[model samples]
Target: MRRNDHSINRAACYRSKIACLVFFAILWVAFYHAPAFAHKVTIFAWVDGDTIHTQSKFSGGKRVKGGPVAVLDSEGNELLEGKTDENGMFSFKIPQRTELKVVLKASMGHLAEWKIPAEEITGSGSESNTPETVEKASDKTSTGTGSESIKTDVEVLKPTIAGPGRKEIEEIIDASLDKKLAPIYDMLANTFDRGPGLTEIMGGIGYIIGLVGVALYFSNRRRKE
Candidate 1:
């Protein structure tokens, strides 16, 4: 009877150990394979005659404030002067349907620009377009003066026309605001694409399971001793 009771107890201990291992394995898998939610990029830009007011935000939804927002004409003439607000919001106007350049000058001297297509600015609302190419232009003046300027040139390869009439320009502007924001959409989508993968998830789960197995093995050995 004593030997039988001892065997029963040993069997019960093994079952308990298996149950604990299974519980931890389930938890590890759940954490490892959890779905990552998609993030949105928010950009706001206002236009008035060859000028644009613009702002940008990252995935965490924090705006870049106090940045210099410059609007330039196709000829590189400075048209409107503006600065980003406390929340990174900006407002300015540009010439009607004219190809314009929007630039952001960060405090650390980092510069980014997007060329506004002529079709994007003709009408009533704001539109966004990705600058096809980005280059770092010299912000320093050639003249012996120490004055600095953010002078990057972005070219609009394809000019989109807003047709002939005023009404047509208005219609085009209204229709393209959503399309203008395409660059920002693409940026966020690409970020998610480059994030963690299924293999990484599986590896994380496997590591956690291995740790739990090690702990259980020692626990069982001690019990037997």
Candidate 2:
């Protein structure tokens, strides 16, 4: 009877060890694959004049890279459809002003939207206030006598006509901005994509160990009974 009891205890200990190992292995696998199974996406967008610019990213700052973008007017009609560039940016010029809704579809079911009010597109806010400032400046210049007014007007018109069109200047500015921002974007992507941190891994392991301990405690109690 003594020998038989010893054999039974040894068997129970072996079973408990195996159960704990199996539980930890399952936990590790679940943690490792969690990110891949999750659907996490976000988007940022803005309107500049008639053009709408957008960027889409995952939780880890991984750009949608290239994906379809749809522009809809307030009436729910599709105005334009295009794809994002490598930088996760896309722009479309609208024919007229209206409240706009831009939706990005990165993949099968991932979607994000940006709603731009009509006032924003029509320049009815701070943008509309700009002309008043210019008019006030013009009035001051006009008060400087006819000759000075003529000279000032000529100087302003010369740069407007001879230097570059508004569109060209805007493109050049956008290009320079993209160049400067590229590194920052890359850094964000790298930083976020590292996935589960040390704390998360440790916490998962702790949970598995605790669960195994509980299981063994109850199991040993049952064997004693």
| The best candidate in terms of lDDT | 2
lDDT of each: 0.58, 0.68
Per-candidate TM-score against the hidden true structure: 0.36, 0.44
Alpha-carbon deviation at 93 in model 1, angstroms: 1.8
Please list all clashing residue pairs in model 1, or write none if there are none.
47-93, 48-93, 48-94, 49-93, 49-94, 49-95, 50-94, 50-95, 51-94, 128-180
Alpha carbon RMSD to native, model 2: 11.6
lDDT of 2: 0.68
Candidate 2 lDDT, tens digit per residue, 137-180? 55664576853645665588784544443334345655565567
lDDT for 111 in candidate 2 is 79
RMSD each, Å: 18.4, 11.6
TM-score attained by model 2: 0.44
